[model samples]
Target: MSSKHKYLNDWAAYFDETGKVTRFAFRFFREAVKPPYEFRELLKQCYVIGYQSLFLVGLTGFIMGLVFDLQSRPTMIEFGAESFMPGMIGISIVREIGPVITALICAGKIGSSIGAELGSMKVTEQIDAMEVSGTNPFKYLVVTRIMAATLMLPILTIAADGIGLFGSYLIESYKGDVTFKLYINKVINILSFGDMVPSIIKTFFFGFAIGLIGCYKGYNSEKGTAGVGAAANVAVVIASLLVFVLDLIAVLISDIFYEL
Candidate 1:
């Protein structure tokens, strides 16, 4: 194909996919509200997507906090501002890094897992079997997962932020002589409700995006085992990208609301 023709084709395909995903998301909303309320399934998903993923998320958060502090130490010390480390690191992590990092980690773990699981079911006709048996697969499968992710991510982000701050405290204690109480006081002094609320709010969107992309990819998967692998890979990629995109939009919205 010619370059121009290929570009046009790709663009058209992109729009087509976007339309389909948008419609799929709408269907989720519609089915979500009119349900028999899959509370058990939702709780299971929360355990799987949130509680199960805590170790990895916490580990990543701790490392991120420690490394961020260490990396910024030289710069702060150069400017004779080493004492500002707690406030600076705390605010950054609480307001942005904590949520974004946690979301990205969940995208990789939870998103890929959902995609692979559902994709396998799709390939094996399990979803179809559910339909034939008069089960609302979309409700039992998609809605519960999406709702669990949406609710659990903010909780995970909160946990991550606390752990990350603790990691920073550990480093500070080792490097200097700061006590946990003093470090926490400094962090609290710098942070406010404004800093936290928006960060937490954005995480819900992150979770929803991750779950939505995973379910969409898996539910529409084709080509048997190969499609399952492809769905898992694509779900992670798209969910991670959506996290950044949603973060940007959240920042813009926060700025506007705060300014008002």
Candidate 2:
């Protein structure tokens, strides 16, 4: 094929992939809302996707806050805004860094794991077996995973925001010589509901994107083991990219509302 033809073909394929994933997410939501709630399966998925991910999320959250505070301190000090460090970092953490970083980490850990597990199931024909046995495999397997992810991610982000702030507190106290009481007051004063609400809301969209892409990639895997690996890799990549895109839109909306 000519170079132009190749480029067109690639673009077509990319659009097709995007559409397929969108349809898959729609199907998952449609099925999830129907009766016969997969309570047990949903709980199991929550354990697998959410509970299992706590340690990694917590560790990353703590480090994110610490590093952000340490790095920001010098910059703020140069501007003689040392007193506002806690407030600035608090707003930054709750509004942008905390949610985006947490979502990316979740995309890497939860997204990749879900993709690999579901892809392996597809490769081993286990998903087919469930379907053959007259089970709604999509509802039971895909729905549960997606729902678990949707619910778990917001909770995880909340925890991460908290942990990250605590980490910032520790670093600021030790490195910046700020008192705990003043730090707490500064943080509380600058961080209004405006900042907190948008951050939390963005996480929901991030979670949905991560789960939907991961499930779509795995459910549609093709080349056996090679496909399984590809699904996991692509799922993380797509989910992480979507996190930033969604974050951008969210910030735009937030800016409009706040008249900023």
Candidate 3:
């Protein structure tokens, strides 16, 4: 193909993929509410995606809180704003850092797992078998997984924030001789309903995007074993990128809401 022709073809391909994903999303919405909810599978997936993520998420949150607090201490002390550190950390963690970090972690962990699993099923023709055997594979598989992710992520974000704050408190206590009660008071006094609600609302979008992208890549996977790996890798990349995009949108919306 000529260079211009090839470039046009690539653009066409991108648009086509976007359309297919949109249709896939619409189908999910349609099927999600119809009937015969896969409660069992959803519970299983919640366990798989949510419960299993706690250790890694908690560990990461702790390490992040420790490192960020420690690094920020010298700066705060230099500015003679050391007393403000607890509330500052609280605001940063709860409002921005916690949800974004937790979502990114979920994007990597949950997205790749879903993609690889469904891709393997596709490659092995198991999904086809389920289809032929009179089961709604999309409902049983895709809807359940998506709903599970959507439900689990907010909880996970909350967990990461609380644990991260605790980690921050530990460092503050050690370095600045701050009491737990005072740190807690500072954080509580600084935070409000507005700060939390938007952070939480965005997480649902994050989870939805992650689950949707994972399923889309896997469900459409081709070329056998290689496709499975590619699906997993692509799912992680896209989900993580989408998290940042969603976070940006969320910030804009929050700013507008505050302005109103």
Candidate 4:
């Protein structure tokens, strides 16, 4: 095709894809509120998606805190602002790093997992069989997973923030001789309710985006096994990108609110 034609085709494809995704999201809302809730499956998904993900997310947060403190300490020490470390780390972790990092981790782990699983079921005709068996496959399979993710991610983000703070404290205690009591005091004193609320709100959006993207991609998967892998790969990429997008929007909204 000519360059002009190719460009137009690309834009057309993009718009078409966007429309499909929008419709899929609308369907989720429609089905989500209908009767015959999948409480048992939702609980199972929460346990699998949330409880199972804790160790990995916690470990990542711990490592992040240690490394962040280690890297930032020298700069603070040079500036004769070593005492501000706890407040700085606390604010950064609670306001930004904890939520973003935790969501990114889940995008890699949970996003791909949901995609691969649903894609496999699609290719294997398991989802079709469920429909044939008079089951609401979309409700049982998609809604539960998405709802579980929406519920669990905020809780996970809070957990990550706490663990990250603890890890930062360990580093501070060793290097700066800062005690836990003093660190906690500085953190509490410096941080306001505002610092935390934005992060908490953003995590819910992140979780929703992750689950929705994963399920959308997986549900529409075609071409059998190869498509399943593609769905999984695309879900991770899109979910990670959406996390950044959502985080940016959260920051912008917070700034607007702060100014008002």
Candidate 3 lDDT by residue in tens digits, 1-260 = 89999999999998998899899999999999999889999999999999999998998889878988999999999999999998899999999999999999999999999999999999999999999999999999999998999999999999999999999999999999999999999999999999999999999999999999999999889999999999999999999999999999999999998999
Off-target runs (Cα >4 Å) in candidate 4 are: none
Name the 10 consecutive residues with the lowest summed lDDT in model 4.
193-202
Q: lDDT tens digits, residues 1-260, model 2?
A: 99999999999999997788878978987998998888999999899878888888888999999998888888888999888888888888888888898899999998998899899999999999999998898999899988888888888888888898889999888877778888889889998988888889888899888888889889889899999999999999999999999999999999999995
Q: How well is each residue in 16-44 modelled by candidate 4, as lDDT tens digits?
A: 99899899899999999998999999999
TM-score of 3: 0.98
Query: Which numbered prediction scores highest in TM-score against the true structure?
Result: 4
Off by over 4 Å in 1: none
The residue-level lDDT of candidate 3 at 10 comes to 99
Model 4, residue pairs in steric clash: none
lDDT of 1 by residue, 65-116 (tens): 8998888888998999989999999999999999999999999999999999
TM-score of 2: 0.96
Where does model 3 exceed 4 Å of error? Answer: none
Worst 10 residues of 1 by lDDT: 65-74
